[model samples]
Every structure is written in structure tokens, then in C-alpha cells.
Target: MRHEHEPKQRKHTVRNVILTVILVLLVSVGAYAARKYYNIKHAVDNTYQSAGIKKNRNANAVIQAKSPISILIMGTDTGALGRSYKGRTDTMMLITLNPKKDKTTITSIPRDTGVTIPGYESESPSKINAAYAFGSSGTAIKTVQEMLNVPIDFYAVMNMGGMEKVVNAVGGVTITPTLSFSYDGYTFTKGQSAKMNGKKALAYSRMRYSDPDGDYGRQTRQREVIMAIMSKAGSISSLLNKDFLDSVSSQMKTDLTFSDLSAIAQNYLGARKSVSQTHLQGTGQTVNGQSMELMAKSELQRVTNLNRKNLGLDHATTGNIALSVSDASSSSDSSVQSANVNAGN
Candidate 1:
């Protein structure tokens, strides 16, 4: 009986020790998370504002409310060349997040899309991308609002140079090149799947002229790299890497508070699983010696309706005024744009 009792006592002691170790680990992890949150919040505070524009109606809103939101992601050329913050916006994407439907829609606006920037007072309509070159990101945000008739809830600006740092930090990303091209001594074969580091990804996104579909092809590649980054950044290993975290803090600027980001990550990140990507449509032509992508007013209205519908906003506000435009004449551009709209995760 004593031998049997001794064995039972030893088993109970081992079980208790294991449970104690697990509880210690859980407590340590919780403490580490709290410290990390505080440090990040401190680092992200006091970023630049959009100068002189009204932010979306989410001033008093919380992510827990689960309302639809729109964010503008702009790739600025300033940081690459060590210039001032005033630089041309080469890439712009509008993202609509709908928590109710668990879907995200990302729409790319062509850099050359012709539109009149409000308060710009130019002699004639200029390329939409020039809004940033003329008046910084504030002007760009206001111009996008005026053109699309959609409220932008948030805006994030990333320097082109930062792309390389971010990609390299993630140990590179895998992408399939749609068109074969060489730029800056880097060669990309058509329809080839390859892992790309910072330099290659930058070249991949910057080679517009070499692409059969031109700027539209560039947009598709940009979106692909972005999605790959998102995938990598979602991993615990990537998130825990000090270099990656430092790169993100140094390279990206946004209007989102740390609390806002945390809440979105907690509640709305799942919507990314059903993302739909699309690009604004237009016909490229030269007007007054200036090249432009003239988007039909009808096309703009169509995109506006799509975004509004996804945001759970009332559709009655978008009128059918611009209804008499023709289809895009660039077949390659249209095909690339169409294929990306339903790109799967």
C-alpha cells in the first residue's frame, strides 16, 4: 500500500508542476504584450495631419462599432530622393472595408487620370497625381474626395524607398511577373514566379513603360507585392522581428491612432480574406501637349457607386449624370484591370 501511495503522490506532484509552468508563461506573455502596446503607441503618436481638410465622420467612432470605412494609401516619391514632403504621388489606392459583409475592396487610381484639383487654380485640368506634387498629401486627399465623391476615413503615406526596406525585412515575397521586362539592370521574365527582395520589388512596381499593359500592369504588380507583404506581416515571426517593426515605424505615416489600428486588427482584419481589387478606367490621350488618362464622367460615377454601396452608404446620393461615355480603348489595360478586380486572397 505504501508503494502504491508513493507512486500516486509523485504523479499528482508532476501534474501540478506542469500547470504552474503554463500559468507562469501565460502571465509573462500578457505582460510583454502590454509593454509592447504602450511602446508602440508612444512611437506612433504625434504624426502629421492632413493640413486643412475635414477628416471622415469617424472622429467619435470606434472600431467596435464595426462600421464601414475607407482608407487612402498613397505612395509618395519624396522620401526616395531625400526631398521635402512635397512630391508626386505615383501610386494611389482607395480601400473600402466592410465589416458587415466581411469584404474589402481596393481600387487603384491611375497616376495620370485627369481631374481638376480644387484650389489648385491651374490653367487647365492636370493629371490627378499632380495634386500631391502641388500641395502635398492634404491637397491630394481633398482632390480625391472631390473627384470620387466618397468620404475618406483615413490616409497612409509611404515613401517609395521604404518599400525595399519593408520587403527585405520580410525576407522577400513571391510574385509572378505578368510581363517580361528589364529596368535598372534587373530583368523580369514574363509569367514567371519568383521571390523578390526590396530592390526587385521596387523595380517590379516601377517598370510601367516596359509592360504590355503599361501603367495598368504596374498597378497589378504593385497590388501583388502589397498583398504579399500583408501575408508576410501577418505572421508572428515577422511581427516579432525588431528590424521589421523598426522599418514600419520609420517608413509609414498615417492618421490612424494606435487605438484605431488595434481595434481594426482585432475586429476587422478578417475581411481581408475576401478582398476585391479594381482600378479606375479611362482612355489615355494628349490634351494641350499634356498626356492624360481621361476617365469618362460615367466611369467615375460607376466607381463611386460601387464604393458607396460597399460602404453601406445610401445609393440615392449618387446620381446618374455621367452616363454617355465609351468603353476604354486600350484592350491590354482593360484586361489587366478586369482580372485584378476579382483577385483572390
Candidate 2:
């Protein structure tokens, strides 16, 4: 009777162990399947399709020399439906990521800055914001490329509707206001550091009339909000959630492919540490009976040099683009910078 009881106990223990192993395997497979399913679904839905974007199949060729890459970051006011021909870029930031120095520079163009439209020669000088309405991202990218004489490698365009979602997704953001100003029924006091949500964050950035520096003040706030977003983005927790990824996919329109984005995420994480904020210096004036912000020839050369130097390009070898601008500047004091042309503020 003792021997029989021992045999039964052994059989029961073996059976339980086998069942536990099976359960573990099943759980592991299920999790993998779920992850794969979500990845496929999101990829299909958010696959970027844009004309101006080009992929370097040989990633080695693109980054061998530690050259700087330029990305045009446009925050559109497209609401929930996403970007279209009719949409406008409410926020425009030109970001240059220098791999050699591991530095980044952000130049914010005012929405009200004046420029000449490429195709619409008859339209006279117009506000920079009107370029999108006149043409698509290709036009916008081209306009900026011409203005700055920098190659725009990629673009990440997102709607303002996602601003709130992004802030909430990241928990929240802390911002230090330089001056107190109220707009759109929101009140912010000077020297106050406030925790901002999405709507409040939008309000914080959009209030310009009350600011002493006009659009420059507003642009500064916008940069602050962007920095806050970047800070939240850096906290690894933000990237772990499937829900957050899906929401971001829905909100952003980009020319960046998944592989390109992955490489950028890996290689350029350190670039954010060296962010420099630059503003274009120009006097507000009217050109040909149209309101414009006229940037000096010297200022244009300075910007061009900064961009070229950041890109690790030998100024003499990087095509005659720089020289062309330099030559154009010699004849006319008011001759507009090509890179500044058609760039909406």
C-alpha cells in the first residue's frame, strides 16, 4: 500500500509540472502575437507617404562623415482630421542635428514673416504662412531649403489637436514664464513656473498681443513648450505604452520611414543635449507696397555659414549655393536671402 501511494504521488507531481510549463509557453506566445499584431496594424495605418522624402538604402553612405542633418518641424493647425492642402503651419521650426559636435540648433520663424512666393510672382511679397496654402509639403520644404540653403532631409508634421494628447501622455510639463500675460481667457503670471496641460499649453504659446516683444515673445514660449515636450519624450516611460504610440501615429504626418526614424532615434538622442535657439534678426518693413521683415545681407551670410558649418560641409566644396547667395547680396542691400524667400514666419 505504501509503494502504490508513492507511485501516485509521483505521477501527480509530474502532471502538475507539465501543465505549468505549457501555461508559461502559451503566455509567452500570446504576448508576442499581441505585440506583432499591434505593430502590423500601426505600420499599415501610419506608413508615411510623401513626395519630398528620400531613403538612403545605404545608411553608411549618409552618416560616414558625421554630417549634420536638417529636419523641418512643422506644427500644423489641422485639428482632428490631419493635414491637407488647406491646412496652415502655425509653428515652424528648423532643426539642425550635428553629429560631429552632437549639437542641435532650433531656429523659430515667425508666422507673420514676409517672403516672396515662388510661382506666384504676381502676388507680390506675402506672409510666410501662406506658402502651404499655395503648395504642399514639397513646396514648403523647397521654400525653406531655398531660404536657408540647407538640405531638408526629413520632416515631422503634427497637428495641434495632438498637443493636449501628447502633454497628457507624458503626464504633464513644467514651464517657467518670463512675463505675466493673459490671452484666450487664460492667466499666467511673471516668474511663475506652472504645470501645464494640453489646452493650457496651447494657450500659453498662442498669446502674442500682450507680449512686449510681439511675435518674438510668442515664439520663445512656443520653444519652451516644445522643450517641455522633448523633456517628457526623453523619459523612457513615454515610449513604453502602446496606447501612446497609437495616439501619436494618428496625430503626426511625416516623410520619415520607420527604419529612418529608428536610426535617428538611436544615433541622434544625444543631439538634443546641445540645442541652441536662434532667432532671425531683421527690421519690420514694407516691400513693394507689402509688409515684410527685411533681413540684412550680413545676417543672411551669418545664418548660411552657421548652417554649412554645422553640416560639416567644406564651404568651398558644398556646391556654389553659398556663393550664389553671396553674389546676390553684393548688388542689392534689400535683395532677399534665397533661403528666406517663400519661408512663412
TM-score of each: 0.76, 0.71
Q: Report the C-alpha lDDT of model 1 over 1-345, residue by residue, as the tens digit.
A: 011123433333322221111111112222236546544454455333444566657543835587888878787644553365456777787878788898777677888776656675432256677777767677788778777888888777767767788789888999878677889778888788989999989888787787777877776576567667756765444554556655655665667665566566656655654556567777777543445787776667777887888888876443221112232222223332332222210
- Candidate 1: list runs displaced more than 4 Å: 1-32, 46-51, 56-58, 62-64, 78-82, 191-195, 230-234, 316-345
What's the number of clashes in each of the models?
0, 7
Q: Encode model 2's per-residue lDDT on 16-85: one tens digit a residue.
A: 2211111111112223344454553464248365745343223334544345777676666645634344
- After superposition on all CA atoms, what RMSD does each candidate show versus the true structure? 15.0, 17.1
Q: Pick the candidate with the highest lDDT.
A: 1
Kindly give the stretch of ten consecutive residues in candidate 2 with the minimal lDDT sum.
Answer: 18-27
**Segments in model 2 whose C-alpha atoms lie over 4 Å from true places:** 1-47, 52-66, 81-85, 230-234, 287-290, 316-345
